[model samples]
Target: MYNSQEIVSISNRNIPSLITLPAELVYSILDNLDMLTILISFCNVCKRLKNITNTYHRYKTFTILNLTHHRINEQEFECLVNTLQNNKTLIEIHLRCNKIDNQKTKSLTDVLKTNTILTTLVLSNNTISTDGAQYLANLLNNNKTLKELDLGWNQITSEGIRYIADALNNNHTLTILNLQINNLGNQGTQYLTNALENNRTLMTLILSNNCIDYEGAQYLANMLCKNKTLTTLILSDNRIGSQGVKYLANALYNNKTLTKLHLRLNRINSDGAKYLADALHNNNTLTELHLGWNDIGNQGVQYLSNALYNNHTLHILHLQYNKIDCIGAQYIADALQKNTTLRELYLACNKIKNQGAQYLLNILKNNQTLTTINIQSNKIDFHEIQYLIDILEKQRIQF
Candidate 1:
């Protein structure tokens, strides 16, 4: 419809410029271009290109880099460490289940000295040796930004824990530390808890599956008496028997900061429950107690139930797989009628039959604070509990 010259002029305006391309495509083009071309030759020629360059630079500033299960070896991880040297915005580095070992731990930890914003470094489930913990210890000694360091499921032994304990003695910024399932025997726990005596910043310390018994627990109890900062302590899957709980319970009588204590599968029996109950009677800060799977029979529940009548701070209690029968269910039901603070009670995998279910049903009608109750695997028929569930709000009961 137009002349050749007029049509050619209109086509010139319709031609797509590099700035009009897709964002990813433009970024790819910039990645291939040199600095001089980006700054002087190409980007300066277009106003939209400058805006794209700003986005390009912003996209590269990674704050939370999660390269989990990437199998990144020492050589590949060295490049990441080099990038972190200049990355001030990065706060968390999760290289969990990577191929990191003890040989090149220096390059990995050396860059942390220059980084000021990184707060969490999770390197759990790695092959880092006991020797590698020395480098981590060095980082923790002077680094100020790191708050939580998870070195769980590694091969760090007693000697390695000694290195970390020495660092804790001087470090002040780190708060949450996880050293679980590392074969840190009582000797290693002794070294770590001894360091905790001087530490002022740490709040949560997890030492689950560390082969710790009463001797290691004694060290922690001793530290808790003097250290008033720690709140949550998890000692699950260890060999801490009745004596270990006794040692910790003795500390709880005076420790005003501790709120949650997890001692599941630690071989605690009726005697251990009595020790904990005695402490609960005097301690006012503890809110959650996990003591599942330790064969604490009806007698143990009686002890805990008796304490609950006076304990007003506890909100959650886990007693699953503790051999609790109908008698134990009655004990808990009686306590809930008077106690008004508890919200969740996990009693799964017990021997609570239809009679036990009825006891809980009668109490749930009157108890307003108790919201969640897990009675799964308690050998009770659904029909036995459904009639009660129909009367009250069924949302609180988990069969």
Candidate 2:
């Protein structure tokens, strides 16, 4: 006897009670919904559904940047803010490459001030300049929940980094910070390095593609000698050559926590490699080292090979596109025979011909640890490929 619209309303009203769904189940369903869809569908539901959807577990991980590069806009972001403002359950928000400006950053920070649950925030590749970054740094000074932050590829310079460094001294929860590709130069690196001497929570840092030269690198090296929590440091493409790299190698001799160091595409040559080899001989923690795209030829490889005889922690070494020929490949292969830890090696696009390939084959035949070797685009022949594949198959069977 009821009208169609009336009946629809009654059914919608009774849907929650009729289902007898638990609160946890409702949360799980909302958690699987995308940000935009969560806003649309959950908001359209009854007040109870809206309340349940606003909980922390429902929309905790907001990944604005997926691999496809479909970034969010300001209005949509604001819609998100408005939807979650009173919810107090959001935890992580990733806003990579969304073209956000200072105004939006300010607005976002204002909302973040009330957001007690958000512990991880990533705003990489968004041109958030010094002022914009400072706004977030200010939030960090008081934010208790934020434990990880990434502001890489922003326009934040030395002055902005100083603000962040000041916050880092007192901020205990933050463990990982990425300032890579930012304009944080010598003065900025100096500030950060000095503060790191006092700070203990920060465990990993990426400063690649920044304008940090010998002075900046030396300052960081000094800090590395003292800092205990930091394990990974990336300084690739920084032009920190022999002089700077020697200081870093000296620091590595003393630093116990650092396990990975990336120095790719720098001007680090045979001289720098010698310094690093000396450090590797004594250092026990460093497990991965990337020195690719440098002019570290046969001489450099020889020094590194000698270190490999003593170094047990290094499991992966990348030496791709470094002008290494069969001579350099032979030196590396000799090292592989002694190195039981090295499992993966990259010698791609180095003009390595049959001679070099044969040397690598010999290493693979003896070295049980070497599993994945990239000899792609080299001057390798069919015989070399067959031999390498056979070795890999044999290893797979053993594993």
Candidate 3:
């Protein structure tokens, strides 16, 4: 047995001091850690480590500037903004669910004026009204590096959207913009549609859960007819009815650049589905279509199935929660036999019974292209599930 002094000597000899290591080696270890870990664990360990972590280049793409769930006050937010301004390497900043108002937004805009490396900024679930939006729009006029901006669930109304539209008319580097769950009525949508006519850089636009009516849908459809750069459009959970679907279908027949369209949780019915089917027969560029949670019944499924027999480019189809019955499943199963390009099919939460499940299982025996089929929450029995598992196991071996 050794004495206490000898034990201390042995432990000290075994454990080398991390602070005594070379600066280059310490930086190499800190470079592998994420921003949150570095900030929380190493930033306050010593002055030297904090300086080294601040200068690390790996933080260029550091995401999640999240203040949500943390009781951060104004002084802390200002300090954070100051730190961000000094570090010229950050690429993304997420300020979601932070309850930020116009006063807080001023600090962010001040940093945006000089920060040239940030490309994505998410300000979702805040209280940014017209004044805050104007500040951001003003920054957009000069900032050239920002490419993606998300302002979902904010208090942006038509007046606020107008400011953003005016900025978008001239800004060229922004490519993706998300404004979902705002108060963009017909007037605001018109402003955006008009701006899109001249803007050439934006590609993806999301307007889900907005109060856009059929008239507003008409404005966007008109833009789609002439806009050549936009490829993804999400308009889910709006009030666009069958009439709006007809207008969009007409535009889709002539437009050739859009590749993805999401119209989930709208008021579209069988008539709307028929109109979209007509458009699908002529449109060749669309590869993904989401029409989930609409009241498109068996009649609507029949129309879409007939269209899918000839449509070759569509690779993904989402028809979940649409009250589809066994006959509707049969129609889709028949289309799966003829449609070769479809790789994914989402049919969950419908009224598909055992017969529908059997029909799909039988089709799966020969369908080699389909990689995924979601049929959960249906009326399938235990035996049907077992049979499906057996068929999938066999297919796995065959492949």
Candidate 4:
């Protein structure tokens, strides 16, 4: 009994000193610690940190999955949702890899309806179906605080996309929406295009690797012609072949808001390239155009050179992995004498030889705006490499 009383006296002496430390310092110590372990271990520690009976903001960002990557049950999910709802300072919630279904969606919606300060919500790799998507859309329509919503790698089909489109029609605060790798096909793309046509708040939309083909390209291109809000449009790895390329080219002739366009891995051959080159002469807002890994060869290069004479808005042009030889290089070099806005030009991995490298060197001799030129992984000889290196060294010295 004497020994027990002595131990209790020592423990009582330590309690006051632990509490005497500043609250800010205590919170800062917890902040620097790894959040995943801290959140899981806090409940096991003494009552001060573990007691949700005291304050709610002790847990800001919830990651229910412990270090072992086990599934967090519905009860634990509800606890996290309630804790986040009670704490207004919660800014980011990452529920990645958790199999969240419709029932979980309701619990999440309840929390979202009350939480007004959340800015970034990541629900990737979850099993939220059409019903859950509809619930999320309803919550997003009125909530204006969220800025980024990532639903990538989810099996959200056309039905879910429709709900998202309806939500995007009125939700003006959201800036970045990433829905890549999802099975949103032509039907879903049409709904998204409709939303984009009327919604003017979104600035970046990434729809790569989603199997959206020529018809879907036309749907988005028609919207791009009139939307006047979107700046970056990524359509790589899609089957936007010759016809789709022409459709986008025609839209580019009048659309003045889009600045960057990614058309890599698309079957845009010389004929389609000619149409796009013609549009480049009239379009003035586009700054970056990526046409890598396509079939646009020497004929396409010649056509693009014709547009380069008058085009002044394009600053970066990527033409890697095309069958452009010395003849195509000469055409671009001739235009480089007069065209002035282009700064970065990527011609790597093309089957260009020493003659083509010499033509490019001649262009670099007189061109003023060219900054970084990538001619790597090509079949150029020693003489051509020496000449290009010498030119670059002389230009650096002058600058």
Candidate 5:
């Protein structure tokens, strides 16, 4: 009903318009905001803003979950999934600690069915069960872009692990899988070991805190003897006893592809240590060995010292909290004089006294290859620690 002049005047008045801003400038501002903030606050402001936020280039790595205790409700999860469907540039998604259950996982797996750009998916600390894992396993069967999948601290039991293991047999693109703190006992370990025997693309496997016993360890050891693609294996906090260590040691003598092995808190005693030491005498590909929190005493340290004197590829050794007394420290110190390839040594939380510290300091003063050495939480006094620090500083080393 207004006249032409009045309508023109109203339109010409001063007004703020985000749509008038250059697209490049808007993108620059959005680049500084977190994905959650953009998704929750900015995307639904208007059609223009939604279009700008949904641009795939703005989200190559989207992390929208609350890592703390804050829970994302079902509606927000649906919105996230819808956004993911539009983002063709997203390469990584981290949904850790989001309380995602089987129903919510369907939305994610549905997007993954056609997602060709996503390479990493982290769903750790969720409420996913056997059915949810089956959905993910089905996705793995045909998905070619996914390389890493972290399902740690979920409710996946032996049945769920079997489903994942079966999928792994056919999956050719996945390289890293994390199943830590799951309820995968000996039976689940058997399934995964069978998959490792034939799978060629998997490179790193983390199965820590899974309650795997000696039988499970034996199964994995048998697979290691023939598997060629696996490079790292973490079996920490499992109950693999001395017999399991012996089995793994026998495999290490012939395995050529594995570079890192973690057997921390596995109840390995001096006998197991001797077995590993004997295997190290012939092992050529292993570069990192973690045997912390075991019962390897002075005799075991002496055995490892002899092995270090001959091994050439070992670069990192962790022997922390293993009841290593001053006598054990002396053996390790003497071994350092002959081992030139070892670059990192962790000996913290031991019983190394003043004399033991002196032995370590004397060898470290002359050594040139060792870049990091941890000697904290031992019986070495403050003055001795300061002296060791001074010597390392003089040699430009780290402790």
Candidate 6:
């Protein structure tokens, strides 16, 4: 943090000051600073400082520029993008919660078209709608190096998604796409899945809270039958009822690529859990399954517990906020005795009382594979929690 202007002005006279620090010391300082500070201020100090910055390996490798929630406006955002236009080392830029609108998105698109190094762009929680999406869609066609794009919490409608879907057909580098909380209903989901059938590079697709129901899920199920690259699909907070779950479960039987599926808050009930449980019986590829905030009761938990007996691949299972009671907890506890591959189990916000809690705590003595087990917000009182803590040495138990 040396003062650059008065490098020689002890003038008060001519003594060597901290501003005359060596290149090595300056490089060490650059290692800890963000890209904005290094580029906008440090690099502008002098020719010597700029040269030292260009050669700083630590600075060069610090590629991610995250300005999330900075609340930057149009002029500031344009200036920021313009400053980063020619940066070759930055690979990711996060601008979430900024006040970027359609015009600012255009500025970003224009800047990103020529920047070959940047691969991830997160513009979530912004004000960009349909027109802004079109700008980004156009950028996708020109920028072949971008690998991840998060446009969640926007108002990009079904119509805007069409442009992105069309662009995906030709785009080969983008791998992760997050469109969560966007009002892209069934039609948008259809467009994206149709394009994904041919696209091979994309692996993670998040479409949570999109107003999609059985019809939209059916399209995705059909696409999953043929697509062999997608690995993670998050469809939480939709209307993917039991019938929708049925379609996805059938697809999972054939899908050998997907490893994670999130269907929380989808209005799924006992029938839906049964469908997914049946799929888990034969499907060995999925590693994480999130089914929280549903009505998968004791019967549904029983069905899933039975599947866990034979399943060897699943590592994480989230059943939180479901209508699971003491019986459901017992079912899960019984399965843990034999299921060694399962590592994380989430049973929060359930109705499991002392008896059911004891069952799970006792089984943990033999089940060493479980690294994480969340039992918070359940019906177990503080005394039972303290009892478990004493037995587990406060090291193994996390309540």
- Score each candidate by Cα lDDT: 0.88, 0.81, 0.85, 0.78, 0.86, 0.88
Query: Per-residue lDDT tens digits of candidate 3, residues 1-399?
Result: 999999999999888666666778887888687666564456556667667766666654465455555645675566676576565656777778887898788778887877788898988888999999999898788889999999999999999999999999999999999999999888989999999988899999999988987999999999999899999999999999889999999999999999999999989999999999999999999999999999999999999999999999998899999999999999999998989988888888898878887777678888888878888888777464575768563433211
Q: Candidate 5: lDDT over CA atoms?
A: 0.86
Q: Can you give the lDDT of residue 127 in candidate 5?
A: 93
The top-ranked prediction according to TM-score is 5
User: For model 6, what is the alpha-carbon lDDT of residue 108?
Assistant: 85
Question: Candidate 1 residues 82-105, lDDT tens each?
Answer: 555555567888878886788656
Residue pairs with backbone atoms closer than 3 Å in model 2 (clashes): 56-89
- Runs in model 1 deviating more than 4 A are 1-61
Off by over 4 Å in 5: 1-34, 40-50, 54-70, 384-389, 394-399
Candidate 4: give the clashing pairs.
Answer: none
The TM-score measured for candidate 2 stands at 0.85
TM-scores for all predictions: 0.87, 0.85, 0.86, 0.82, 0.88, 0.87
Identify the runs in model 3 with alpha carbons over 4 angstroms from their true place: 1-68, 393-399
TM-score-wise, the better of 2 and 6 is 6
| Worst 10-residue lDDT window, candidate 5 | 61-70
- Worst ten-residue run, lDDT, model 4? 61-70
The per-prediction tally of clashing pairs is 0, 1, 0, 0, 0, 1
The C-alpha RMSD of each candidate to the native structure, in angstroms, is: 7.0, 5.0, 6.7, 4.9, 3.8, 5.5
In model 1, what lDDT does residue 302 have? Answer: 100
